[model samples]
Target: MIGILGFVAVFAGGRWLGWAARWVWLLAWGWLLVLLLAHAPYMPPELGAFVGGEFRGWFVLGVLAALALAYRTGLRRLQGRVAPVVAEARPGAFSAVELDRYARHILLREIGGPGQKRLKAAKVLVVGAGGLGSPALLYLAASGVGVIGVIDGDAVEGSNLQRQIIHTDARIGMPKVFSADVAMKALNPFIEVRPYHRQLEEGFAAELVAEYDLVLDGTDNFDTRYLVNRVCAAAGKPLISAAITQWEGQISLYDPTHGGPCFECVFPVRPAPGMVPTCAEAGVAAPLPGVIGAMMAMEAVKHLTGAGQGLRGRLMIHDALYAETRVIGVKRRAGCAACGGG
Candidate 1:
């Protein structure tokens, strides 16, 4: 009874003093060792009686305590190797897994924890899931945008495999938006992905654009571009629009509501049919869309997190063949039909 009391006192005292767990455990072990030695056969009979335990009983207790400590240590090591569960964190809060995943972004001076949190709370809409949209969507997902919406009517074709990195060969027959959804979710499971497996039209374009904070237009046709511009201008939403051809690509942030020109302000007249050839007609280079698409994604991140200077009121032209890039100044036209210079 005295031996047990000594052990309990040692442990309790160590804990009460806020000692390290290892030190507290060591002190408890020391007490047990002292008790064992007192009860040993070689020890004096009076000492053994005072300790109140047989030598063999104390020895068994020490062995059991060591076993328990070893078992606990091993269990802790196993738990350390296992991946943590990614629970659905509360709104505006981050999970442990998400924090580790975006540790790099959080470490950046421009995009610290507050900016990362903004990214996780933002919702962005990509108007196309084609060549330009592919890289933009992927980077947005990897950047931890909270909600991403992709819309496209076409199915993935074998030709898209060359530059559209998001879609796989197996998904050739899948709708572009669905394919984009799969890739984005596979990249980051924390964000929400909405796939509109149909073309954007007058019936739902306005309603759709209204649901998001920002819009990205990567469509190839003039009609869709004008329609997107019109809808975004009317809704006062910032639009990041980009286009790519054989070896050249251009991108701009058109937000007349925020001092930048709308798409129609820059290009007031659409070209006649066959004047500006489509990708199928002109055959775009494989990496052109990737370069411009990544720029679009970068601009989106900057816009959402307020990280750096965006392309608002500026047009960025990239010539991949010559490795040249230039930013030209542009302004909203007062007579423009879309935004009417706000």
Candidate 2:
């Protein structure tokens, strides 16, 4: 019992004091050899002869095992010292676990380690945890964006289960922001999720837009969409806004600060009353939001990482029923209202 306790203490201390790691196995094996040599004298005549003959073999085996342990322990300690130096040399260095998690992204020449680092350093605010917000938030979190803020005043309902994929049926009646927060955090434990369980009002929209590097407007209503657009434009932050209704969806990045058209450049005036119907009133296809929202997430990734050409001055329109996709060039309307004349 004393020997066992002594062995445990030595092993723990050796591992803790890394400089003593290589000698631990040597000491342990030497102690075992001593015990065997001491006990050999008291054994029976036959046993004594057998022990004398086997001593050389046992000694050789112990030495070999001790050498192997020494090599392994020394290498581990060396690696432990070198890892921090390597991490310090590279900006935004990732841990072994993080590198493995984002291995696929790192492999992409377009979005390699530098791009992944940018994704990790980005801050994106997504307005409305509804249809378009669902997939956008999910993919953003999965992509490793460092911080994601989700704002919504509504709660999950039985009717929302059709298009809002982030909210599970069990989460019905829960605040949409909280549901989204749970989903995003579950998808990527590395990212931060901020849930604003309130509506996006003009009084706070400007301040909120200024806080984020980018804004994604997935709100279902025209009022909030225009509000987000104006605030993002005023703050010079890029905005990725997408809308889905019935069978079609539209998405674009509005950044007049960088010469891209703002949201109001294309739609200077809201449609005449009753000209356009809400998704709730007109009914959207289940997959329409999924398609548009995923695209919105993709655009956000591109914008943050500078990986590929973004939808800067172009609008992407997808018609699910017709199986058609089109891109239209939109220019900033100079001398007009909203983002113009600034």
Candidate 3:
């Protein structure tokens, strides 16, 4: 490089002047800088060596800049690998079995590990372990809700087999709550199943509703449904209620505390006697409860996990005969008696 610079400088001095001379001078200086950086040694060597003078400064600066850039690149690579480990090590995280069991849920961006944690921390009370409650209870348990409480006094019978899939022929005559408990436990041993083994009457309703974060009403009678709605409204808990008669079924999530209507707001006055018939009276289709009960369970899971939008303020109606469905918006009644006229 020095030999080349010498030749250019000689030519500039001989034939070139002014601008041409300046260009040659610039080229010479650039070549010298390249040699100092690329060929010079930055490490300590014999004192006053050839590469030790001012050129050492240039070599040292170049080495320092290279090291800084390499350090930054390495740090980014290390962080990329450490982030997943840190997230996996979060406090109170899931076990290997839990991760495996809920792999599909975790894979969903809307309902991943954090959503599953919310579900596990949730406490849900299902009123009535009959028709609608059967599938609802099974699904809630299978979804790994932390605590599930079921209240019912009715016993499983042969007639319930048509729509209530949670009970078996062998479990007939067993109290509905206990039967639900057995089924739920068998589905997921990680969850706790509390069987009330009694009716959800006036005296017990409030206390039971207060114990849970959410309530699901699947009772067969309008009186029980009204009672459960009033109790849930008083306790400031969300309620998922579903009912089916004949070939039609309807489900909704009623929560006046949030932005939705309470059950009483939608049905201010229960249908007069002989107006709204019971499932037994009207003969509900076998798959009607299963369909509605699963929908109730779906709404419950959404509410607990904060995944998708729930059925809050929306009633979902299904007609099996026509194979059609529709959703209707419902609003909270400002003067609703059940919701304290709020």
Candidate 4:
């Protein structure tokens, strides 16, 4: 090549530039020869054909990567849809079999095997630990409600010992809410118990109540009682309201949407301090709270199991000392302060 360039430079009158350009071409051609020799010193026809194939290896890798990503994303979405698991209701760390753990409950015409399992999977939040809360907590926990949340901000006073069957002398100084949780869990290890040892108020109240499937208003005070009820109504949850004072007790279930009045409709606001005396002042019969709270649990279980006619539209009142029970039919108040058109 340099000889040809030299001949051209001699003919065209530029010999020095032609020499430099020929040297560059020689160096590039030498590198190319070295590369091919190192790769395959003696390349056969079949080896050349194999190496010259299209970039399908990279294409196959890309397809596989895309498929793997798609599968991962779909699997994650399915798992998210069924999260926050409820533990299976088989008796663990206990001797009762499936048939025995629920034998008494199953005997009731309302709760069959399917209904019993539904109760096992359901979660219930009881809003107090005083009078009405005592019996409700006991029965629901004993019946194997999978999850039970007790929300209260009080202590186990000596006066509360009679009606609140779950508390004991050792727990007298403990917080009422936490004591209730320990007692309920001890009664049935199959249950998961949570304690809300604070008052349920606006802003922070709805977030806690939203986690559970149903709400039970066993609170003794009026304002907090209405708070739980209205929050449940807003969240489209089933609300079971029970109130007891003096010798009187009432139990009712409300679904805010289906044209039934909510707690706000029943009591527009907290009553004045001395307007209606509390259990302490009016002096309730010792066993009255058990009657009310137990009824509250009953209504909540029925709502969860869908076992029988729910106490959705009717309010039940009980007068134990008088031995009288009354059923009051209630309708959704059109202009209820809390739940009206909300």
* Top-scoring candidate (lDDT): 1
Candidate 4, residue 300: how far the Cα is off, in Å: 1.1
User: Candidate 3 regions off by >4 Å?
Assistant: 1-91
Kindly list the per-residue Cα lDDT of model 3 for residues 16-99, writing each as its tens digit: 554575565456556456546544456444422443345666556557856986898899999988744211222356778778
What are the C-alpha RMSDs, in order, of all predicted structures? 14.8, 12.2, 23.2, 23.3
Residue-level error in angstroms, candidate 1, position 86: 7.6
lDDT of 1 by residue, 79-132 (tens): 999998753423587888899999999999999999999998899999899999
Clash totals for all candidate models: 0, 0, 0, 0
**Top candidate when judged by TM-score against the true structure:** 1
lDDT of each candidate versus the true structure? 0.92, 0.85, 0.83, 0.77
Model 4 C-alpha lDDT per residue in residues 100-200, reported as the tens digit of each score: 87888888887877777788788899888888888899999988888888888888988789778889888998999888888887777677888988878
Over all chains combined, what TM-score does candidate 4 have? 0.70
Residue pairs with colliding backbones in model 3 are: none
TM-score against truth, every candidate: 0.74, 0.73, 0.72, 0.70
**Model 2 TM-score (2 dp):** 0.73
Shift in Å, residue 186, candidate 1: 0.7
Residue 147, candidate 2: C-alpha displacement in angstroms: 0.2
